[model samples]
Target chain A: MRAALAASVLLVAASAAGWWLTRPPPEPPKVAEDQTFEDMDRAEYEAWMQELGYTD
Target chain B: MLLWLAVLLGMRFGAEHWLPALAAAAEQLDAGESMPVPPKPTGLASLPAPGTPGDGQRATLLSPATCEAMVADLRDVCWQSLARQVAPADPDEALRVCARVAGSEMVLECHADVAESIAVADRARAETICAAIESRKWRGQCFFGSGLALAETDAEYAMGRCAHAEVYQTFCRHDVVGEIALVDLPAAHAQCAREEGDWLTRKTCWHGIGKYLARRDTSEAAAACDASTAEWRGTCYHGVGWGGAERDADATLADCSTRGPYADHCRHGVAAQFKRADPTRAVALCESIQKADTRARCLDFVTR
Candidate 1:
């Protein structure tokens, strides 16, 4: 009876190890929320436009 | 057999827990709650039909009380119309009226945009209008806009006018020179030869020139880039690859080998360009990449 119990526990442990090893990748790093590709020229040009409730 | 069954069960159990977590995270990202509220645009959109009388213009024609009423409804449109009508007649007068209707920032922007608008046809008038601006910063912005407009009609005039924009000289030159150089390399180079300043500043203009010129004559553009000083050749060469990615992926990918540090960037750009239209070709191109990591990424994108 003791041998059977030991075998069962070993199987469960090995299975858990395999599952952990094959887990999915970690989440990707998030980009900044307020990121802007525009240079100063465009930024200044668009600030007032944006302030007036503009899109596109 | 039972051990194999346990392994399979373990895999299912792990997926059940982690899959939900991953999915929740993904949904959060898709919702875009991380980004700030996007600025709403109302100025041009709020304006009345083009060519038709804008509400602000009609308001001014009616009376100051009517114009004030228009401002109560739509301040941006009201001030914009007042700006355009009053600017031609009296720029200082336009600023005063626009200030009353809008915030301090918009007031300044109104003056600058108005000056530049007039500058498109008459640079001198724009300069004169800028002189009347109360603040130095507003005056520079006005002059910069004037330079940009002047570049469209005459690059030489833009160069001369941009020179006088002391606070915004570098930015003004970049805007004007970059604009002219995009379509007219000869004009840009001709001006660059005579006017000597910081090479870094001039590189901004040449970068756009090389990108445009590559579409017309790749070999000549490349040759011209080679003849240029080392100061600007890297960006100039990058432009060639960038332009090639837009129109000729194969040519760009083949040229990548000659570019050492910039090779992967060029190849990836080419791969991305071809990936959607002809994925088989994109996968084939990815196979030619020497960098293991870059190749893996390209393969994943094309295959996905």
Candidate 2:
């Protein structure tokens, strides 16, 4: 009985390892919808243009 | 182990290529075909030759120095970027910036912008800023400039102050109307439609709306003018034709041609526009104009 249990545990571990190795890799992380502006000038310029009715 | 290695390697390649791909996308987005044009911006009228400053260019920071350095198309970007950068944190400094600019017109533009910025905090000082301007020619610019900036936030108050101005009151109203139409067409229409002012003021207001409509929503131009009073409708279409003519002569004719009296005027405008490129074609256009007198005038104007 003890020998049978040990062999079963080993078999399960090997199968799990094989599945992990074979599964498709995750997709590259997606960019966030609202990324921060690159700089203060860009942020300020965009805000002013919005006020001028040039942007939504 | 091999699968894990492949996944990690794929991510590394993606990371390495990400910035370049983003940069390429950015370049394409900025292409002229994709540039977002707002409705009826008189400022954009200067886009073709952004070297010269135009109305509604009030918000740009393109000082004389910067403007001189840039080519025509890039100057618009310069104007867009710099509008708020050199705005006066102090009233005196604002004056200094204006003073540094050489031309009287530019000085007035500077003061007008500065005055408007100042008015946001202190209305009296803003007036004082304009009052300090030395040239009479620039006075109108200052008053209208302040009014234009004020219209962005407080249209009613800006209009009221412009109306109250001792001098340049008409200019004040016309310019304020131009800016207001940019934000709310119906409200501007109602304000302009009120029979309180002179015929010219009302007519000019409609013209301002026409210019706005021509830029913002091309399809709405005729409908908007159709809703106006008969006296000013032609005037409105005149500006509409003017705006359309900027894009194409055919666009002008298509937009402004009517069974109405303004048809000749609209044709004349197109001829004038065509005159710039092909004088012979412009003269041919003039001959097609219905009114004999206007046709003669257009022919002479184009030929000369």
Candidate 3:
């Protein structure tokens, strides 16, 4: 009876350890959206032209 | 005891499953070691109520008084920038940049600064900036400011006309002809005559004489006409006839006949006036012109 109980305990411990190791790691934090400096440059250019008498 | 150990290990594994997630949540929430809190977006949040004093269709974040103060500040900056720059390599680009500064509400304090900068950089560029400002639809302030700036520079009469026409028209009619006294009227008249197709220039020329005529009697009006170029003389005679002298139809015909080229047209115009005033005198004067075609036309009118 002592031997059977010890074997049962070992089996349960092995199964739990296996489950923990095999499970996927939590996903990494999501990357924030990328932005470009060019958008600001273009906006500045448009604003400049509007000030100058080039209506188009 | 073995079963209890197995249960402890299972609980440990379950705890392990949630531990990383819990750690991440805590990290995200943590205000971590003396770092400043990010400022909230108060600009958007603190916007004034709709329809408030400074919040109509043309509402700006700055009040009018605030904008004026900013404009004054910009004027100083503009003067400083202008002093530093000798010339702009690209006048067109400079004009564009200056114009932009002039128009932006956020940067409006920079408008006068930009204008002064352009003036120091390139006078032509400054004019271009003013012209651009003048062309916009709702341009009361822009037009007046730019117009005054342009007047300081030497643009053509047309540009001056464009600049002054809007504002001057608002308060009082612009005596375009009267303004010509301050300019080279003959050259301006010729330029206008060339650029404006049809009879617009002729009309303007006639209108312009009202200023000179206002100071003169009929003889001086005639002498001024005589001293004028042939085209202008013709116009001057026409002006005289139109300016309350048409009652003496025969005299107008005699005066205008001396101008030649337009003589036939003038004769016909006088004849029409005479027919209105005294048909008999018009028939006699038409007969005296000795052109058979003219005489016949005159007789036809008298007969009619």
Candidate 4:
């Protein structure tokens, strides 16, 4: 009986430790705002084009 | 996890604290530097006369630095290209380069691009960088970049990143899912089906498949769209129209009729593309749509 009890205790502890080891991370608050390409500078546009590989 | 949470909190709350420091450092560096003209490419034959047949092909091989020296007008573009190359490895130095840029928008773009570059290896750091950006537009672009890089391996995670991208979030899907579509088209479609969002989000997800696929092969893209569920078929067709417009707007508009029931939606997409450049043509195309609601939306796109 003592052996079974100890195994149960060990199992519970392991499960708890597992949960602690792999948990979902806390995320930042969601904020919403909008802007358009018209507001983008030519340099910024060029940078985007380069990022997209549209130009060298 | 605790440290990660703290870092996120710091980014959310303390961006203002670091920005000035970065600016000051940038200023110090800028003041110490001299604006010397960029050097010309060595070991290159000169005298490529303008309009020469091979001249344009050779220009494509020139480095950004060489281009900057050759075209004095587009100096900022050259700097941006140089910074883009530096961002993935040394973001701080890239930011310093961006800081000296005359335009504030370009500065924000530099930050966004740097965030994207680092996201390939360290997404957590990239998100922190994105959250700290002041402009909503650039922040979205930064997240979009992160999502694009992440999509190569874990598309679901990339979609999660897309959620953080502010106004440009819709476009993030357009490119991120579009990237996936280029590889496994069916999987891309399945992802769009499982995606949880508003109608616009769902529409853009499907649109991405059509847009990116159509860029490679129009007929295949069309077949892929036809294979999709009826609910999003029109959306995909619209994407095809948009893709085609990049090359030839007139041909794209004319080809819409071949789409049958979805033709009006295709025309709607074409009209949207033309709204900025040729509003009259866009309105005329909108008028051609038989569907009253779609026509109204197309007209709205043209007028607005």
In terms of lDDT, the best-performing candidate is: 4
Q: Which regions of candidate 3 are displaced past 4 Å?
A: A1-56, B1-195, B199-219, B222-236, B247-266, B278-287, B290-304
Model 2: residues >4 Å from true position, as ranges? A1-56, B1-84, B99-109, B117-124, B161-172, B257-262, B272-281, B291-304
Share of native C-alpha contacts between chains A and B (below 8 angstroms) recovered by candidate 2: 0.00
lDDT of 1 by residue, A1-56 (tens): 99999988988986895565445433332323322223334433323211211100
In order, what are the TM-scores of chain A for the candidates?
A: 0.51, 0.50, 0.47, 0.45
True contacts kept of each: 0.16, 0.00, 0.02, 0.06
Please write out the lDDT profile of model 1 over residues B97-165, one tens digit for every residue.
767755564566677767865665456778887777766556666676777766646888877766655
Candidate 4, residue B57: lDDT: 56
Backbone-clash count (model 4): 0
Q: Judging by lDDT, tell me the better candidate of 2 and 4.
A: 4
RMSD of each: 12.5, 22.8, 34.8, 22.9
Candidate 4 lDDT tens digits, B20-137: 6556555644542221111111101132323567645533553545635755446656666556556655777767766755566667777777676667667888888889997776
Listed per model in order, the count of residue pairs whose N, CA or C atoms clash below 3 Å is 5, 8, 3, 0
Residue A8 in model 4: lDDT: 64
Per-candidate DockQ values are 0.11, 0.01, 0.01, 0.03
Question: What is the C-alpha lDDT profile of model 3 across B1-304, one tens digit per residue?
Answer: 7555655666577667767775665564342211111111011113223345543533222232343455664653443333213123344443334343442432322332234334422455545444455322213222333332333233253234333323221111113332332344454344334434223333334433422342233344455455555554544443444331344444555665664554543454345445544655656656765556655754664334
Let me know the DockQ for model 2: 0.01
Instruction: Kindly report which residue stretches of model 4 are placed more than 4 angstroms away from their true locations once superposed.
Output: A1-56, B1-79, B102-104, B121-125, B131-137, B250-255
lDDT of 1: 0.57
Ordered from best to worst DockQ, the candidate numbers read 1, 4, 3, 2
